[model samples]
Target: MSEARNTFGKTSITQKSKKLQPRVDLTAMVSVSFLLIVFFMLSSFLSRSNAMDFGMPDKRHIDCGTEPYCLGEDRLYTVLVGINKIVCYEGNRLDFSNETRSFKFNDNLLIKEMISKNQFLKNFYGDKKGLIVIIKPSKESNYGNLVDVLDEMAIVKVPTYAVVDITPEEEKLLADK
Candidate 1:
């Protein structure tokens, strides 16, 4: 917006001068702004978001003692997710009695335990593949527990892992606890 003012300062009768008004053109500014918007819109990429790497095992390779050297109880680490509690076991079995331990979620006892176990196994066996985690979410568990266990697995850097269903014996043991 602009205003024009005309001034008459001691003008002579024979000589008179016309006052000129300044004009500002908004067309160039508007066009430049529009062009910039168009450029940004065209330069932007519209693509799908990346998914988290869950590291799912291949079904074709899974063998429950159908082949030799299959994943056994000692090499496998089972993480049972429950309401505000976590139960972890290491072995080739899911009997829920051998080497089973429980921890509350508040102190991240599960992750700390997992880290210690991984470190111990790494130092003892000298093999990263020695620690395979089998995440078993019981009926008492929720999605948050599952997610937390997975996050802990990532933090602990477990080499092999999977999410499996709970067995009846395991459910009975969980109820007893």
Candidate 2:
């Protein structure tokens, strides 16, 4: 004879059958993934469209570099654009006492002077490419002032430019002057 078995809960051991329910709420997951995709697309677009702005000189490639590795060579005339004053330096030295002294950016005369001087430099050097303006702002200068100087440089159509900070050596030289 067959034997009867007892189960934890139910009418009888073999009376009820077990059933499994399939579960999958994919709607929330799909919504989240879609939102993530949209967010990333927008973020990437914004980042790609942002302007590439640089501040200060890139010391690694240009500043403190050696020989031909340094920025602004003999082929380019170097113009120093400072917030309070714009001075021109050549051969990495500013000699005010020399007969060929530096020019200051003041009123409209400075721009005119720059044009004539740049013309002379281009004629002599045979590189009419454009001037190389090195922008240096004094520590006490405001950002707006620096921007104004940059605007003037832009108006003059500088080919390319770099920024230089007043190093301890440069400051001492200026102080001695």
Residue pairs with colliding backbones in model 1 are: 72-92, 73-91, 73-92, 73-93, 74-91, 74-92
Worst 10 residues of 1 by lDDT: 60-69
For model 2, residues 1-177, the per-residue Cα lDDT tens digits are: 999787556665465567879899899999999999999999998888543244565566443635533644543444444445544445444445422224444566556655665666678767755566566566655676667666665566555666677655444443333
Tell me how far the alpha carbon of residue 101 in candidate 2 is from the true structure, in angstroms, after superposition.
9.8
Spell out the clash pairs found in candidate 2: none
lDDT of 1 at 9: 69
RMSD of each: 10.1, 6.8
Q: Each candidate's TM vs. the true structure?
A: 0.64, 0.50
**Leading candidate by TM-score:** 1
Off by over 4 Å in 2: 1-20, 47-92, 97-128, 151-157, 167-177
Whole-model lDDT, model 2: 0.57
